[model samples]
Target: MKGNDHLITAKAPGKLYIAGEYAVVETGYPSIIVALDQFVTVEISRSKSFGSIVSKQYREDSVFWRRQGDQMILDNRDNTFNYIISAIRLTEEYAQTLGRRMAVYDLRVNSDLDSPNGKKYGLGSSAAVTVATVKALCEFYQIPLTKSKLFKLSAIAHLDVQGNGSLGDVAASVYGGWIAYQSFDRNWLMAAHRQQSLTELVDQPWPNLTITQLTPPENLRLIIGWTGSPASTSHLVDKVAISKSRQHETYNQFLIDSKRCLNDLIDGFKNGSLSTIQAGIQKNREILKRLADFSKVQIETPTLKKMCDIAVAHSAAAKSSGAGGGDCGIVVIDKNQNIKSLIKRWEENGITRLSLRVHPVIDLAKETK
Candidate 1:
């Protein structure tokens, strides 16, 4: 664990999508993301074996990857390790652009975000792992990585495997903390991928993306409660897309309403207007319910509804966060209020309050040094 130039380690935090889940995937819409203290850590050192980069993770001790003519070839047979392999492939390709070869290193990934009994918390772990892996590999090869560069590389890797994500999670992992982000153009990126010339895209100016770091407004405390389950964000997003295709007017109205609510909330944060913030959160919750009614999807399950109702009874503004069918619900509470009673109430209702803090960093490159 002692310091050495040869041994490189990086940790990236998981994220919570505070607002703008499905809408932010569009080119100009904005989303709010906060990095959590829970993290994925990657540690790398020179490998004992030659001609192969070895990876070790939970239960799968030895998976090796090698390169042949710019293509990364895996020496194992498990889809469980695809994310790691994809990160390695993208890193190797990027290093080759800079006239350096990716080195063979023993890379190990571990996470501290799981529950005591090994259940996932839906805290953007994949994005954190991919970001950490990219950082570890780039450092091992001595290739300087800026925030923009890291985002591009991480997005490319993620896209290659997952196919479609807003990359808001990627942004959160690369640049930690509470941030307002606008999605980049996926079509342009897909074209770059088709050309197999990521170097050009990486070198090009970044899209007109805005990622601003902000502190929680005064006296505002964030309350995160888990429903003791996981919901597939992709599944929910795809379902919404299906609805959007058919219910164009409904989806459009929902967009306008959400955008208005988020703008007011963000402005309130800047101006220190707690009332405006609370109102915006409350209205957004109602809007979400209406969207569920329109789409006929269970966006807020009974458990989430109960959690939000509990928060409201405690004089807090609450809603199910992210693509919520079964996952966490976030409550915006006043710090001055006694939350002990509310916590007990939540527990009695089968809701588990989670301990999370924001991970703050502005520029990824500046922070790496």
Candidate 2:
């Protein structure tokens, strides 16, 4: 595979939710997300007979696929490669619309978002992989995809497989760095996809969707701690949606409060106020706790509680990351704040501290080529 005359490689970074968890799913509601240094990379090279996909994360379960008219037909029903397969199908369709030639290619995927033992860190691998695949294929076909186009295509592919997600992670993967993101109206996009060309659908402005890069305060220090337990974000989100349907009034208020809290947090970033940012995180944590009690869902486990408490005790702000029934907890402190004791306490309670920094944004002028 390495000896191929032309090999196109692309990597997309993993992400963590800084704030606005359950609320961000709704159209127009915003959340803060940061792309981490870890990534999922995809490599594509010409294949003689048929296209195949191999993922290091999936071990022995490789997928053999071929084109059936305009569709990708996988040899097996293994769901592990659904995200990658969907990306290939959508990107190829888009390429065909632009009169770009399509051909068989062998695709390889590698990820650094999970542990060596295959334990997930809940770092949004699916989103990263989908983004990387779209990026790689666009380059392979010489499509000259922009970052925004890359994001739109990746989101469509991911949603086609997963069926649901706020797609904040998709935005982070495409844009990189810290961003304030609001999800677009998925219903509208689906409707437009049926009526418009793939190229037209991607170029049009998505209703209510916005992604803005944020500049963190100079003194900010983000700390990530893994609880050694993986959580299913889709399952947790499904349960919350069910509870929300039964308790509309309570859920509505949660949305309102969450929007206000995150606004302050975004403002803190704009004003370079570390104290305001910490306060906003503290408030959001309390709001999530109330939401959990009413919905009877455990967004924060006992282990996560211990982690947050330790951070608060040390004068920092902490909360469960993503849809946390388990997995990672995030803490925000001033760079000047002494956190050695806070880390010691977390280690004593069996939490593993993760050393991850923010991935910077890509220059769109250079990236599009």
Candidate 3:
């Protein structure tokens, strides 16, 4: 088999959910997410000797890996590299199905979402890395890349490692910009994985998954504030998923209200309904709080609550982003209101305001000449 000679590089941005996470995971409801400028980049070029995978932040330990038949055999026992490697293995396997042979190459992964001290920002690093690596490997093997195809491949790789995730982050990374995503059917995915027929999962368009592009009105003001803490989205989601099974009525009402709130907000984004948008944001926050109270999950931590309080004082609506044990909060100021006081109040309360905007996905593989 001829080795891939093209030096391909791909990058994907991290994501922050604006509304409805736990509910999305359970019933495959829609959630709004925005891709950030923070990204994970993977560069693939022909290797001289053997295949190696390296990371920018974790430079201390590098690993040598070989693809045999359909599996990736790595020398290192560290599971930290599983995210990227899982993507590598799946991409190679999928390429083989296209009658394309795999090649040995240097797959270098890098990211800027981490602190200098190696602390994470809870910006969906795993999903970003998985998406970027998958894209890099597919392009390296001369496999055609599409957003839908990329989403399916990336989701399989991520779920193979994490066991469970909503894949909202993966969708945001793949499509970029502001997106409303409905979860893929977990049962269908599990069945396919168990049967070792993941390719069967992507024979056509995803039946249960829905990702739509949406942009906020120009008059609305957006502010992102971080708590300087990384929250485990899976942990918080699991808590709600488990407890919600028993509390049927409460969870059902939450689902109904959550759907309505997001729909109203989406309508507001399409139109210039500032009051409707603000109302929906606050309504969603209250429903999430009620759900948290019933499920015994602290979806909104103390810091997030304080952030929301400050935003409220400034005549803005705020809510905890993502799963939210402790993480960033998104503030949507009605009209073109000033957030200087809101930002100042956040600083006074020790909250960090993160400057993040919608990052449209760029085709780096195509850009490489």
Over 4 Å off in model 3, which ranges? 1-3, 67-71, 193-199, 361-369
Could you give the candidate ranking by TM-score, starting with the highest? Answer: 2, 3, 1
C-alpha lDDT of all candidate models, in order: 0.80, 0.92, 0.82
Give the per-residue lDDT digits (tens) of candidate 1, residues 93-176: 788888985455677778877776768788887788889999888877778888888888988898788877688999999888
- Tell me, by TM-score, which candidate is best: 2
TM-scores, all models, native as reference: 0.92, 0.97, 0.94
Candidate 1: clashing pairs of residues: none
Cα RMSD to the true fold for all candidates: 2.5, 2.0, 2.3
Deviation in angstroms for 332 in model 2? 0.4
Q: How far is candidate 1 from the true structure (C-alpha RMSD, Å)?
A: 2.5
| 104: Cα error in model 1, Å | 1.3
Q: lDDT by residue for model 3 over 1-369, one digit each (tens)?
A: 134686678889998888876777854687888899988999988875578888888887788877665566787887478888788878877887788766678888889877667877788999999999988787788777778889999998998888776889998999888888898787877776677655676676655789988877777777888887878887877788788789999889999888888888788767877677788888889989998899999988899999999998888888998888887888888656777788898999989998777787555445433
lDDT of 2 by residue, 204-257 (tens): 899999999999999999999999999999998998999999999999999999
* Winning model by lDDT: 2
